[model samples]
Target chain A: MKLEKLDPTVKACTSLVCVILLSFQYLVSLNIAVFVLSLLLLLTCTRARGIQVLKLLLPALVAAFGLFVTGYFHGRGTRAEDLQKIAAMPYAVRAAMSTGLYPALQISTRLLAYAGFGLLFALSTDGEAFIFSLMHRCRLSPKFAYGILAAIRLMPNMVREFKSVRLAFRARGMQLRWYSLPPVFTMLVNSIRWSQCVAMAMESKGFDGDAPRTCSIVPKLRWYDLAFFSCWITGILVGMCLLRY
Target chain B: MKWKLKDILMIAVCAVLFGVIFLGATYAGGALYGLLLPLGMPSLGYEPFYGLYFMAVAFAVYVIRKPGVGIVAEILAAVIETLMGNFFGPIIILSGFVQGAGFELIFALTKYKRFDFKTMALAAVICSCVTLGYNLIVSGYDMIALPVLALMLAVRIVSAVVIDAIVTPRLADGLARAGVLGGYAVCEGVAKDLDC
Candidate 1:
């Protein structure tokens, strides 16, 4: 079944669990498996384009490589004894027997696994569907859910305002540094004004924090959500057990 | 305390703004990390910008002056960041929660009254510590050498204090003075101070 067709809440929950569990486990093979499987699922089950997935993975790849180098050089167990042990090993085995090699691989692969799960949920789930699901199934307060939804809708306008503010500054012959505070402050002030107006509009429409409300789009939990969740969990558990032995 | 619709929207918009900033910081941090990779302490790169992450909590709590606003703002910011395609993924939501709770603990201890520099600085320090502990476990910072780890912690705390404590309160107060935060608790506090 298509992962896009699965419940967003379920996908999010699974991805969160996967990330947490993967953090604790340092098994290189398991991490590689999880990363590959997540990528495969994204490519096959979800409508996420291969290029899109690659774009998402690019940062993770760069980070993983940097981490590997960091761990190799500054990682724990780089003492004299560890160095001597590595030196004593045969030439072919020396690289593999380096003091921090194992930990480096573990850390890098774990990062990849995390990115994989993150991309899985992010690419597969629609933001609106996820929010509505939280409102319907997770019982999130309408106050916050709708508030967040409204703010999400305003994001593009905020970006546009940010650019216009910068242009306004430039038009005045003022070159604002990237870390300049005035632009940010201006944006914050504008956000406050906009939020106040939006809030007033919403309140005028009888938006009440305490009042019960009906939703237009309600995402349901299907049998496949459970099936996929259990299958994913069992796969990880089995991989862990087999790797341990 | 009852949260008005205005309070909710204010937090939401501020969170969205900060989320965008946080995403930009992540890219900046990534570049710095790559540059510092040769120093054998690439982890320190991100430490300096750690304070920017807590601005949402600091700004929201200071303006709203309510209990639990920091946590809500932070988590919302994280959700927005994740939706914006953060490279760190959904797990950042957990980091957001931890960072928010760190500052919230300080405000809670003050009985949600103080929004002063001392209080914010203390909150920033506590937030640095809390998130540091989290990274030690989740990000595998413990595997790094002791000296580097200590250095990272120090840089992170200093960054947090500068950004969250120094910059955020001043910006919020500036907004308050500009009359944009008219009906909020910050303006009320400012008026109360003038009466004294």
Candidate 2:
């Protein structure tokens, strides 16, 4: 029942299928159905986490609305089918909303689907475990895999560093602009220094590419992973076959 | 190219730094795009803002001056962003891979020797083109008019050139001048073994 137990590759593959299915699908009903299914899955996994992801979706929703409006206003050359759909509306209203309906729907729904699947995978999966799976199961070289894991591990410290860097700027009576280049520049300098130190420390500790290592938490594909894959793929395939604009 | 531990650690750090920046840009761009939607401009309004996305990888490759650093930095950044609860989720990993490959491919084309502004600009343009293809697939850009698409592409290319080519290298030069990047490839001619 805990989706987190599912193999990351399985979750990743399912998410890909969901994205592809949503991208190709234009029917609002199908998109809504998949969205609901995704929402259910997310909510069932962890209510608090699901709420957090929904909070994240707010901006995406805003962006999708923009895309919808843009598609409606400037999409140009309404399809004949769309024209027939708009044939009955008032001339003024129809002119604005006519040709763009399909496009607007398609773009907005695709964004929703993207956000939904993104939530499912990002919320449920553990980054360290995922990297472990990548190394053990996905045949990724340990150098790249461990490098990425190190980056992920360093994220919290990086955030703290970003704040300190800003404060250091302000301490000198210099105001930092959000869009300015100085903050990022300082961060990069700091990061480069830290990376060198970390690297040197790691090397001194005998870490090397040729060394064989074992994982603390081994990733395994359980029956639920298979079920998760089958359920999502079936839903997506069925939606693709049955749903049309 | 032998990847030393420092090299790998450098990639991780650069990727994390850039990933954080990318996260900030996403929110800022999203808010800006939302603000512009009520006006008539929809897609084009956000294309120029997209240059921020290229800053991390461009700066990383410039400083690192190695093959595959672009891909490593990018994909690592995406992983960090995902761990930070990015709204785009795991697909960002795929986006990072595609974008990094495009960036790395251009440097590869140049045999990894040229870190000139022109090469950086070219690589940025190539990366944007690849991202545009990705947009067409996921965002349904094919549904829009050709003129709009052309305009968007043009703006994107210009943005890429300005941010990735001009700004990133300038920033790297600044970092080098500050003596933080003592042993980096960018700082090779300046000094042998300065304190980092």
Q: Which residue pairs of candidate 2 clash? A: none
User: Residue A169's C-alpha lDDT in candidate 1?
Assistant: 94
lDDT (Cα, tens digit) per residue for candidate 1, span A178-213: 988688778777877898899899889888878877
lDDT of 1 at B171: 78
Consecutive 10-residue window with the lowest summed lDDT within model 2 chain B = B187-196
User: After superposition, which runs of candidate 2 have C-alpha atoms over 4 Å from their true positions?
Assistant: A47-50, A80-97, A175-184, B189-196
What 10-residue stretch in candidate 2 chain A is worst by lDDT?
A45-54
Per-residue C-alpha lDDT of model 2 across residues B9-116, encoded as one tens digit per residue: 676776666666666766666666756677645656678767767766787789888888788777777777777777777788788888888777888888889998
Q: Give the TM-score of candidate 2.
A: 0.88
Tell me the lDDT of candidate 1: 0.81
What TM value does the first chain of each candidate achieve?
A: 0.89, 0.84
Question: What DockQ does each listed candidate score?
Answer: 0.69, 0.64
**Model 2: per-residue Cα lDDT over A69-186, one tens digit each:** 7777767566666566567666776666645576677667778777777777777888877777877777777877776677666667777887888888899999778776677677
C-alpha lDDT of residue B62 in model 2: 91
